[model samples]
Target: MSELKTKPTLMEPKTFIDGLSDEKKRNDADALLTIMSDITQQKPTMWGDSLIGFGQYKYQYASGRKGEWFRVGFSPRKQNITLYIMNGFSQYQHLLERLGKHKTGKSCLYINKLSDIDVDVLKQMIALSFQARFDSEI
Candidate 1:
């Protein structure tokens, strides 16, 4: 089997955030780091070159694809701040409705800036995603 390319690294999260070229994106990333850290009660870790991951869990697919991944995370992409919501979005319609301006993929929540969203809702979503991973393991 091929190896996972996005494993955790020893790269410092703050250093990575500090190096972002866009000032607004860097500030948004900092806010996200604080919020996710508070919610997960874990220091963020660098996942590969970009993602700032909070906590981790092991996952195995029916097709035998398996790996460890973050419970919740985000990246300051050039176009948007992408949040890794680990659990898919099917269960959080209410929260999403109130999340303000954002987009999503299979497990990503994309936002242009922190000021555009209701941060409290974002925190709840992150906390829910973080807890769900542990809850499933029990």
Candidate 2:
């Protein structure tokens, strides 16, 4: 089996966020780190240099490919802030409608800035996604 490319790293998350050249993106990344940490009650960790991950889970696909992944996370990309919902977003259309300006790709939700979305709704979405990780364990 091939290895997972985006495994967690010992790299400090705040240092990574602080190194971003874009000040706005840096601030947003910090905000996301706080939000995710608060929701998962877990400290953020650097995943593959860019991703700031919260809690973790072990997943084994039907094909027998098994790996560990963050329960919920986000990356401050050049174009937008990409949030990993982990469990995909199809079941959250109702919440998405109220999410304001954003785009989705599979389990990722992209937003240009936090001001572009309702933070409370985003928190709810993250909470639900975070809860789903534990739910699947049971």
Candidate 3:
């Protein structure tokens, strides 16, 4: 089987966040690190050079492809911040309605900035996604 390209690295999550060239992105990434950490109660890890991941889940497909992935994660990107909400957004319509300006693609939640959204709702979404992924894995 082919290997997954992105895996955890030894770099500290905060250190990676701090190295971001954009001051605003750095601050937002830091806030996100805290939010995800609080929700998952797990230390963050670098998945590849960009994705800041928390917790983990293992999966094995019917074809016998087995792998592990982050329960939840995010990356500060040039266009916007991209959050990996493993459980997808359809089940969180209520939170999305109150999430301010954002976009979604399957399990991804994209926001232009933290100031554009209701943080409390985002926290709920992250917490729910983390728990849901955990439950689904079992």
| C-alpha TM-score for every candidate | 0.94, 0.95, 0.94
> Which parts of model 2 are misplaced by more than 4 Å?
134-138
Q: Tens digits of per-residue lDDT for model 2 on 1-138? A: 899999899999999998999999999998998888888999888899799888889877777787888889999999999999989998899999999999999989999999999999999999999988443442
Using lDDT, give the best candidate's number.
2
Q: Model 1, 1-138: lDDT tens per residue?
A: 776998899999999999999999999999899999989999899999999998788876666777888899999999999999988799999999999999999999999999999999999999999888543332
Using TM-score, rank the candidates from best to worst: 2, 1, 3
Which prediction has the highest TM-score against the true structure? 2
Worst 10 residues of 1 by lDDT: 129-138
- Candidate 1 has a TM-score of 0.94
Decreasing lDDT order of the candidates: 2, 1, 3
Cα RMSD of all models vs. native, in order, equals 1.7, 1.6, 1.5
lDDT of each: 0.90, 0.91, 0.90
Cα-lDDT of candidate 2: 0.91
Q: After best superposition, candidate 3 residue 125: deviation in angstroms?
A: 0.3
